[model samples]
Target: MTSGSLHRLTAFTTTANGGNPAGVWIGETLPAPEIMQRIAAEVGFSETAFVAPAIGLERTVRYYSSEAEVSFCGHATIATGVVLGESVGDGLYRLTTTVGTVPVAVRKRDGNYEASLTSVEPKHTAAPEALVTEALTALGWRREELDGAIPPARAYAGAWHLVLAVAEAQRLANLNYDFEALKTLMLRDGLTTLQLVWRESATVFHSRNPFPVGGVVEDPATGAAAAALGGYLRAEKLITTPTTILIRQGEAMGRPSRINVDIPSSGGIVVTGQAVWI
Candidate 1:
């Protein structure tokens, strides 16, 4: 596979320069693991998606960060959906990922394409106290800086994430962390990202993700993290009703992104966003 065969897109935002940039490769067959890894590293994006275009509505997809393969990736899935929509047709595509089967819906809106992905079954568990302590230490944040209401959790939809809610939005914005330390912690605990967030309102949140494990200091927009957060809230009973919430991420990095998460009483969490060509 060559770089020319890849499609560069930014997900979760319509702006040409905003959102998480991902490399989407659509071909007759998936690339070899080594080739995909090399392509991802060369693309230099947080994540690159390798997809075998669907026969009918089912497509085989794989997600790789610059350094390793991820079981699932939301932004890359959305970007692929838009690509498929433009190349195939606007509708639904069932993506078979390493983790599980995910269904992505695509449509054209306002001259740009939008995609919504339904994650696999969502679940969460209490984060290990030791892990939380070590993570806070790496982040240089005091225990009191965390939001008591939301608490800390190891949330999982397609991938595992440590969800930490900050008491104030400003604390979430000041993101200076020991990258090596955090990366070590995340690798040991098998966490994809540290979802540091502040609840702006009952249904609105501001977030920043530290993704050193992916060889990136920060992910401008993280779809898996948003799905995990929605699952975390629903599991913890923080969300009492079936509603839609807004997650505003990447703003602190100057690459603003918007993710819409719809939580139901049960089942998969729906994460929606728009991707555009960069």
Candidate 2:
């Protein structure tokens, strides 16, 4: 229950300057829920992860944002995986999250540690017309700017997200929105973040995640959202299965991050990124 138990790290970084910062707390037993919330708020990251021992290579994990506890968080999970790899050996570790059980593999590649987590079963549903209109209004976006090929959807892969695809990259780059308005809408609809994206190519995409629910303006690297996006694409038959796609995020925020997603024919999506000790 002390600050000394907390470890600060950055995930999905290509360099030290890039990536999303997260606090990882590894303890023999988790602290009380209120204590965890206080620690996460003090850390003030988009999300903080708490880890405790389970069976053999399994661990019980919890995620909390500055505002509240999250069902799942990808960047924080990656940060925790790297920390575990350093303490224990590099291998596969099972994480029991609030949403479901996720399996993360940690390994050292080219003298750097990397982690990949397989998401829970992902599902996507058409967003309600009224909700979409409200979200666009809050974001200061017009309906015409949307990409017709990719419709707006409510996607879930451990966490919920509103997936909005814009027609142009510049549209995605200009991310100025009413924080309070968007936060209110997200909270009402149980959305964790707004997955605003622009497609650069068939296999490449650029994304920005607005995480007002987490008490943060944006998330630099959002693994859970990325997994939901992958599932959405697959379920909609927008992409061929058994393919790998790359997502570039946080460029506008000046902390560039890279996320690699491997989509299989069935089952969970695989999200990969690197973490560094801060």
Candidate 3:
């Protein structure tokens, strides 16, 4: 109900200077929607997670950005998992979200808490040329900079993201977009963030996520977008199954973050990362 009850943590950080900061509030009973929204806005993070007790190893969780409530959020979930692991011991926790059920496993690795969340079934749809063109125009990107191998797509795991792969990492780094223009288009298309990426190697990628919908200029670490990307790669047959890939995000913003994605042949994608108490 108050900011004092919230736990501040940074997710997907490999160092103290990196990661996305989130506010985690766990209670025996969840608060009302308006209250949650108010708390999230006051917290002023990209997203804040509210968790309440459900059945054994299960919890009812809700995600709220400063502006509105989201279907799901990856970084907040990871942060919640680590907090629960520390208080309730390491194990798998089932989360009931607005979209669907997600399973998160928490464990201690090398004296640090690590959490992995398996997202709901991921799916992708081809993006219309007009939509892509509008987004590129808002982003100040040219069509020639896009990667032909990876076409534009609307991908979803827990939340929807527009996947745009660029040919060079520099293109991804030069991220200056019309905030109002992009936000209008994204809201019309029901997009949570734009997953702009560049492939550095077969298993490595550089990414930037613009989250104007969440009232943020950019997200240093985006777990939901990473899961959607994994689903897109698998559906497009761009990567081998049962493989692990590394994502480097937020570097251009000065807050470096890392996300490890494990893609299985069939089923939901697993996104793993570490969170630290801030």
Which residue runs does candidate 3 get wrong by more than 4 Å? Answer: 1-4, 54-56
lDDT tens digits by residue: candidate 1, 80-138:
98888887778888999988999999988887788999999988889989999999999
Q: For model 2, which pairs clash?
A: none
- Ten consecutive residues with minimal summed lDDT in candidate 2? 1-10
* TM-score of every model versus the real structure: 0.97, 0.98, 0.97
Which of candidates 2 and 3 is the stronger one according to lDDT?
3
Better of 1 and 3 by lDDT: 3
Q: Which residues of candidate 2, in runs, are more than 4 Å off? A: 2-4, 54-56
C-alpha lDDT score of every prediction, in listed order: 0.91, 0.93, 0.93
TM-score result, candidate 1: 0.97
In terms of lDDT, the best-performing candidate is 3
Regions more than 4 Å wrong, model 1 = 1-4
Q: What is the lDDT, from 0 to 100, of the residue 219 in candidate 3?
A: 98
